[model samples]
Target: MSTIRDIVILCNNRMAFPAIQTLHSLGRLHSIGVPVENEDVKAFCAVFASDTGINLIIIEKSKLKFQLQEITAIKDLKFIFTMTFPWKIPEELIRQHPNLFYNFHYGLLPEMRGADPVFQSIKKQKNETGISVHAIEKEIDKGKIILRKTLPLHTDFTHGMLCTHLSYLASYILPEVLTLLHRNDEGMHQDETVAEYYKKPTIADVSIQWEHQDSKSIQALVNACNPWNKGAYTHWNGLNVRIVEVSQTDTLSADQHAPGTILEINENKGLIIQCYNNTQLRINTVYTDEGFMSGHKLLAFGIKNGEQFATL
Candidate 1:
């Protein structure tokens, strides 16, 4: 229960809420910095700062380097923590205050190291993931590890769900991290041999690869994209569509039918489609230009039982 002080947090969204609370409770949160471009986070932090009597610094994304240099000049500034902060710190700034900065990355480092590991882990069908607190170094997410708190990746977890879970995990792990830092612990260096880096996911990453992905893989992709990217992107009869929710079906596809073929459309069983293997996926919900609707409603949009949805 070692209480620390003179800390600042840089963040852009709700993922930082838990950590902010933990630091404030310990009386270690001296200030919070939010990019002015992030309207919701900016407004929320403004009110939070007022209520908690913590200082709030509004930052311009373009002027991040200058602003950070100024903020770090405070004689009492002991540590700076960034949680989901958007801009990369200037390499020179990191080099100058290497010990003063740390980041709470919402992913397991050395394996799931990346900007969007929450999405990547779910998309890759990993059964476990964790949060990593590491010193901020020149290379992004390549810092030495201070602490890691892992959790089971539940089968029903979507990208949003896992993000929420990991945010709380960050709060739970923060005290231990602060205690280590208070003791001047240098922390362990990451294993370069097993290290990997995942850049932020893009449209192509969320797009479904019908030709290569089986039913399980497709379902994982769907979960990985839901409530975040809307869903897994695909094309149906020349129209863009997103598969929002799906489940594996017991029925196997016939050898003659290619992957992405519409095998059946049962009212009770939902819309079933062929996948890479003989397995099938039962679509529960979908999103189209019309709106988000039930999978069965695709019939009204002229998607018949034989209509196929293939990769673009």
Candidate 2:
């Protein structure tokens, strides 16, 4: 006879909602909750409140460590599946649980290990990105890969769009991963030689490097940071200016101008700025101190041709 595993799901993000619902419908989900209060967490709690069959535990962010310690004492907890759980699981608990702990990471294992993989993948202009189901270990994301599902990386995908797509993908693959675990299938180990890690991007990291990067790279950076970091940024007359939507222009200028210099201002074609490699970026949408406006409106705000946007 096959053993039925009692699974505890710890998640706080909306991306895990679909997967949570899938597990709940199967009647195999043991417990669910978040480590903190947020819009996503509140939404999940409110939706599941009517279902008295499932137990939801909302641990205070400050008391998460203590609460996780208490969870370790739950008898017959065969597996713990963490989906976008904010806090790191205690190493002691992982050691005690052995192969029972697993996590759903947004990025492919080994290659895009660490925080904000979608953003990194978009910034790097990757051809593909995927989700990974892996064992949780002492190191962050350096775990054994159980299952993976790849998706095409679209150039126009904003931060929010990529996250939404990944969430659905997570929901789709989770049942298969559970089946694999039930069969006691040990996952494949990750290759450390090809591994890459990225820290959460700061404002500086996402800021547009007009002089150093080409137009294509700049456009990718802007798209990668959208609907989350509010797009890649620059400085205009000491004021912060965010480029929300941009496109690379095939039109090349014969005359050389400093990078970040406004090359052309056309109502139909938008504002064009010189970038590295003699390329140009056509700004479609922008956010400045005044408010969100199109590139053509910048001319009315004293931004003219030959004006250079400063980078910090």
Candidate 3:
């Protein structure tokens, strides 16, 4: 068998999502340009920045790392990042050393298979979440498996919280996967039949759809954007209001009032607006081009109880 090369650490945690926690635990790696410092701590882009001979890389983004299958001088002994690694690369970059080695994924390989694995996993409220270390082939997360382990997702875990959990897991799990590679040990191939795909959601995609959705759908929208994009929505009035905090009411009603219409306003309660299907959305926080506006003051500026949102 061939001997191991060097180890690379790729991270894009400027956002410091869950994957960052795990990358922190792995053995140290050399840093150059903006990768760990300048770039997201969870990016595998660091591998080819300077040197190659990288046999391993600890994906830092808590998503997936390394979007490419092959690395010229670097070989990721492992994969870890927020996105998947593509299969092929131009031959010009390849000399003898490879560019990437391996990748780590937040969800089951082939299943829950896409970027924002951690985010998608948590929002779906899966009973369990895990990480995967796989070799970079053409199709992402479709390469030969190197290592994988389970990590539970708690109910209270938000995007931030899930990121923390996965980061910690990367710490403990990476070294173990490396040991396997060192010993020439390869793990199981994924069951392609079970594989499912998810797209990387945009800030606009997760925004509140104040039309005929159910209360549960509203909650999902809120959860999807938490800790990152927050809420994607406009104000109960014409202004844009980023929904920060949300709690569902027990019952659903028919307010006839247009969804996104402000239903109630008070100093203490903030602005309660009619959301999907008569569901009420209590918005405690808002953002204007200027800054933040207190709930009470918003009401004072023509945000009365019965007045339609924009009219007020």
TM-scores of all candidate predictions against the true structure: 0.95, 0.92, 0.67
Instruction: Give candidate 3's error at residue 33 in angstroms.
Output: 7.3
Q: Give the residue spans of candidate 2 off by over 4 A.
A: 1-5, 51-53, 73-76
Cα lDDT, model 1, residue 190: 90
Candidate-wise lDDT, in order: 0.87, 0.84, 0.54
Q: Identify the runs in model 3 with alpha carbons over 4 angstroms from their true place.
A: 1-5, 14-100, 122-127, 154-156, 235-237, 251-258, 292-297, 306-312
Error of 2 at 276 (Å): 1.0
* lDDT of each residue in 1-312, candidate 1, tens digit only: 434458999998799999998899988898899998899998888899999999899999778899999989876788999999988888899889868999888888878887888898898888899988899888888888898888999767988888899889998888789889989888789998888888788888999998999999999999999888889999987789899999877986445678888887767767889888677888899998889988887888777777789786
Residue by residue across 1-312, what tens digits does model 3's lDDT show? Answer: 222323444434533222333433343332211222333432443444323332334322332324223222234343323222322322332222232446667676777788787777755667688778776555656866777788876654667666667666766665576568758665677888888888888655666666655445555555556667754455545666555455555433444777666666787666667766567766655555555565446654566875543211
What are the clash counts of all predictions, listed in order?
0, 0, 55
Root-mean-square deviation (CA) per prediction = 1.6, 2.2, 6.8
By summed lDDT, the worst window of 10 consecutive residues in model 2 runs over 1-10
Worst ten-residue run, lDDT, model 3?
Answer: 28-37
Task: Give the TM-score (vs. native) of candidate 3.
Answer: 0.67
Candidate closer to the true structure by TM-score (higher is better), 1 or 3: 1
Per-residue lDDT of candidate 2, residues 1-312 (tens digit): 223336678887788887877776666676786765676776666568456466677778777767876766666777788888877888987887788789999988799988889899899999999899999998999888999899999988887888999999998887798788878888999999999999989878889988899998998899898878777889888778889999878868888999999988868768999998888989999987788889878888788888999897
Give me the displacement of residue 205 in model 3, in angstroms: 0.9
